[model samples]
Target: MSWGVATLGAPTFLTIGLLLARDARSDHPFFWPSLLGIVALSNAVAILRVNQSHRRAAFARRSVLALCYLRAGMAAGCAMFVVLGWSTGALQEMVATLAEMLDASAPAIAIVMGTWSLALALALAFGLASFAHAGALHAWIAFRRGAPGPRPGA
Candidate 1:
């Protein structure tokens, strides 16, 4: 789920940030290539992890299915945003802005640092979102398992 969330989020922030950095009236773009890459990577990792833990995953089919559904929804949402940005020309503006940044007079180190900083920020945000989503899922799972949750009395 962590990988899944990050996969869904990084491209999203990248496109949205690109649009904003463009100083254009519109602020949206789709990163379709990113969606393909993320979906593949996240699902592969999930399957691999489960297989590696086969002893514990003997009956984990439902959980994995739920994860797949979540990922598909994430991918669809990403596609929608990308299409929206494409229609509005926000994606093109973002490309232009990125090209200009690369062509700026700044030193190579400075540019690398700036780009790295942006990546880190996106990663941090994605990680937080992943954790939050996982927490919610965990709660739901526990509830389904009949684990006693906090209530009015001990």
Candidate 2:
């Protein structure tokens, strides 16, 4: 795999690993791990398929494909999170608490903070997904393309 990919994926992988570790210590450990595994494996397979098919494709084409993958992953992740959170009642609880806190503040301030929180969450999700997709693309490309030649005079 490409070093670039490894570097870019480090944080995401680390975060996943930490979450997996934490889940392992919990009473219901298998659930989150299974879900995380499915998401990670599916994304990897999709990236590999795309990379294999577009090995010799133009940069612009590959980039567009990557963007598609990123958006798809983000949407899937968000949907899964929402569904799980809702089913567990965690989402409702969190929303109720947030509303309570917001209600105690000034109307304009609460509105601005709520909007800002949403924007920040969305931005963070997008950034993480972008990094993961880029890393996957670079990794698959490096794997399929084989080793590169040594630099001149090295």
Which residues of candidate 2, in runs, are more than 4 Å off?
Answer: 1-13, 27-31, 41-60, 94-101, 105-154
Which run of 10 residues does model 2 get worst, by summed lDDT? 1-10
lDDT of 1 at 123: 36
User: What TM-score quantifies how close candidate 2 is to the native fold?
Assistant: 0.49
lDDT tens digits, residues 34-127, model 1?
A: 4345444543454444334443434345465445434543444434434544566654555445546564888889776766454444434433
Clashes of each: 1, 0
Choose the strongest candidate by lDDT: 2
lDDT of 2: 0.52
User: Which one is best on TM-score?
Assistant: 2
